[model samples]
Target: MNRTNKLSVIGIAVFTGVAIMGDAMLSIVLPIYWSDMGLTAVWQVGVLLSINRFVRLPINPLVGFFYRHYSLRLGISIAMGLAIVSTFSYGIFSQFSILVMMRIVWGIAWSLLRLGGFLSIIQLTSKTDRGQFIGLYNGVWGIGSLIGMLVGGLLIAETSIRFITTLFGLIGCVTFPFVPFLTPSGKKEPTVQKTTTDQQKPLLALDQFVLTLSTSMVMGLLIFGVFSNTLSARIDQSYQDNWTFMSFAFTSTAIAGIIQAVRWGWAPFLAPFIGKYLDHTKHKQQALICFLLSLSALFALIGSINQISFVIVLLLLFQFVSTGFVTTTDTIASDLAEKGDSIKVITFHTIMVDTGAALGPLLAFGLLEYFPLRVVYLIASILLFVLAIGWISWLRKKQNDPFAFSVRK
Candidate 1:
């Protein structure tokens, strides 16, 4: 690899680590902060968590534009700077509105760093290693999440949320100087003249982009939105304690991250094989397989609610495998990106993921409020089935042309 490649990879990993750490810290500490401030409703907590992502739905595309037209590094720098300022202020301002505003600001910062880092990685590496590299990219965030939760847990056990937030803010600030190192220094390849087929008709490009994003949205909704949100709530109910719920959630999340990291190193070797088949095979069938297996996790969760130890263990196992597919599918979206708009493609992916994250709590809460827990799982399962049908139809249409990406250069 060239110097630029090495520096960009390292810098991207560091920033990813920081973002995950920040995320992990907020997961554990923010609930505590909310409770201490006399805010103690599941809906309120859900709002606190989900609103950050909801705001990102709009700002995420803008981050993509900045990355595409301007410097990814500059956008990342501004984002990190905002994160530092906003997180530090959390220590001094304890009001609900101020805290929500800080989270909104943090969401924008997260988009910049994450979207930029993903684009940077795509630029720095070749298509052959995309899965392994993307896995590595996500793995870095996993490690960051692990360390953040470990440290945040320790601090909250001994100290205060304010101190933890301040400490994390300092960590965010430290990453600013590293942003300059993330530039892609390699030259772009000389253009090859296009055949008629190479030049797609006008609306086709936009349609493909939207389809890729819709696939991303479905995947994100299942993984981040439904599973994460409902599972957390289920664990909380079983344990009847916030700390216990967080403990299990963080541990499981950390473990999932580690497994994903390890998979990153190995998955690329299989990527070529998978890509060949994935393009021709029934994606919807595979998607159905993914969902069916994922729903089995709800069984484990239901068992956990009944105080079955082995069932909770099974739940974590399901999470591990599900996340592996999630990571792999993410790389698939990268593969499907418009030729030159890799950043925008990935940004749309993130937005879809964030949208799922935002919707998880809302959907879960709405279901829990109006229906039984098992019924909620059934509803989610039905949605997954619908997504599978969509996937199948999409794959059948694109079977002859898997590398269907199209965009203006």
Candidate 2:
């Protein structure tokens, strides 16, 4: 990468970390603080946490359209401004209605940031280094989430949720100045051209695209949507009266945050290796099949096992597998875009992600109300295993096709 590209990546990564910190903090704090904030039902917690993702369902494609026609820097800066405002509101408001509204605003902000960050990586990095850069970008920005988890826990235990939330908002504000450092709108660099067939009908690549989107959706549903809420709820129930860490006396909220942190924070180290492997290998499909099968069994185990230690270990393994899927799908999307218009492919994939994330909590919590927690996870496991089989068949068929879409750069 050149100097300008490197700086753009760094700037965007820093901005992403700051932008996501508030949401990450809330993910840990919200379940613990739900009752105190007047929430009575488990489903309400899911609604509060997922409303942002639901809002993104429509907004992601719009943001992508805007990226096609408008100023990327200006759009991202405005989104940052909204993030700051929404974070500030979280500290000031206690009512459920008000909190939901702030979450909506934060959702719009997030859609912009997510799309902008993705575009920046795609536009700024050279084709050869795209996977490595995407991996690095995800790793770098993931640190923001990691810090949010740790700091949010400590603040809630020692100080106050209000203070920590507002502080995170202020931190988001600090990234406003770096918005100009992002790649300018409507800039495209010349690269090795795609074949006539590759350029003629991008939709012909739908088989690969659909598979990639399915993986992304399942990831959002399982990793971000279901596991985070369920784990926190489980911890809260299991340790109702004894809500403090052993000897150290840290609050259960802190412990929950640590657990969730471990789930997300390992990406920085793992993603680069996964990305490099995909970049250098042709058997990406086989790797993904193995990952999905492992995840299926692990999710089943997580549901059946009652021991907290076992559950934690399973969830951690789930995280590792989830990160592999994330890296693989993203790399695939990037490769597909290389053959045609990137914006359309990325927009469609992001919409699938947001849709799954929006539905995860609603579906998971609803299932929990009717069925045992084990059943919910078992259902997910079964569905994933089935999907894996279908994906394997699809890969076999595609491998035999004369003009199959290649994920290899």
Q: Tell me the tens digit of each residue's lDDT in model 2 across 1-409.
A: 8888877877777787888888888877777877755667777776777789889998998988787777667777878888888878777877788888989999999888877777777787655677777777788889998998788866787887778977888777776876886645553332345788666646545667777778878877876677766776655544435434457764545566677677557777788778777767777777777888988998898877776666667767777788887777777677666656777777777888788777887889899888988898898899789878867767655555645634333
User: What are the runs in model 1 whose C-alpha is more than 4 Å off?
Assistant: 1-7, 35-45, 185-195, 198-211, 236-307, 338-340, 400-409
Report the C-alpha lDDT of model 1 over 1-409, residue by residue, as the tens digit. 4666755766777676775566666676666666764455655665666677888999998877676567766776787788787767666676677778877888888887777777766667665556556666665555676676667766886887778777888888777787776755332221233447547643454555666666577667766777666665554444432334544644443443443344433443443344334334434235434644565555435533556354456555655555555655766676656264466568779989888777776777787888876677667666655655555445445444555322122
lDDT value, candidate 2, whole model: 0.76
- lDDT of candidate 1 vs native? 0.63
Error of 2 at 321 (Å): 1.7
Residue-pair clashes per candidate, as listed?
0, 0
> lDDT of all the models against the reference?
0.63, 0.76
Q: Point to the candidate with the largest TM-score.
A: 2
List clashing residue pairs in candidate 1.
none
Q: Which ten residues in a row have the lowest lDDT in candidate 2?
A: 183-192
Which residue pairs collide in model 2, if any? none
TM-score of each: 0.76, 0.86
- Every candidate's CA RMSD: 6.2, 3.7
